[model samples]
Target: MRQPPSRTAVLKVTAYGLWGGAVCSAVVSLLVSLRFQSLAPGLDQKLFLVGGGMALLYAIGGCLAYPGLVFKPKEGQPG
Candidate 1:
């Protein structure tokens, strides 16, 4: 049987996934802003806002997850 992944591995994956999501969202937002020339400026602005908000949230999640991976107590050490 295969061994299950460790907690640190899970945390690392979570952190990287969140960061990757943030990067993807930012790239998509930039592409949309560049490709779509809407007649209404507000629409473009709203799209940017939504994308930026998502990216910001994802980045925050990554930041939170990273500490868990970095600050894990060593075996036999008091947390």
Candidate 2:
């Protein structure tokens, strides 16, 4: 059986996961935005900023919320 990871280890893993997710999200967003730019004549700067800000907030919330799910304790182990 695998030993439970330390809190610090769990946090480190969470941080790395969050960073990887954010990078992936940003890259996808960039590609979509570029595609939009090609399809549309002009993009609204404020609209783009608001959308990006909302997405960043969502990502931060998910990073804060998901560690509990990822680091679940094994059966018979204290959480």
Candidate 3:
């Protein structure tokens, strides 16, 4: 039989996922900003959409990740 995941493992995975998301968001936002530099002159519309979508993804990821940090099983229970 397979063992349950540990709190430490869960936290580590969550942290990594968040870190990766932040990096990806930064890179993507930067690229989008650069791409629009000549045409839009500023973060007019598309950037907002990209930013908002990234924010939404982060929010959802955080919501899913936080449960692993907040809740843990007892010694006798499966994690």
Best by TM-score: 1
Q: Which stretches in model 3 have alpha-carbon errors above 4 Å?
A: 44-79
lDDT by residue (1-79, candidate 3, tens digit) is: 9878976567557756875786677567767777786775566356856865785677567555654454543454432
Mark the 10 consecutive residues where model 1 has the least summed lDDT.
70-79
Query: Any runs in candidate 2 off by more than 4 Å, and if so which?
Result: 38-79
The alpha-carbon deviation from the true structure for residue 7 of candidate 3, after best TM-score superposition, in angstroms, is: 1.9
- TM-scores across all candidates? 0.77, 0.49, 0.52
lDDT comparing candidate 2 with the true structure: 0.59
Compute the lDDT of residue 70 as modeled in candidate 1.
46
Mark the regions of model 1 whose C-alpha exceeds 4 Å error after superposition.
69-79
lDDT of 1: 0.75
lDDT of 3: 0.64
Model 1 lDDT tens row, 5-79: 766666678888999999999888867866664757677677777888898899988877774444653554321
Query: Residue by residue across 1-79, what tens digits does model 2's lDDT show?
Result: 9978866556557666766666666666666666677555555343455456656765675566454555544454332
In angstroms, give how far residue 69 of model 2 lies from its true place: 22
Ranking by TM-score: 1, 3, 2
Better of 1 and 3 by lDDT: 1
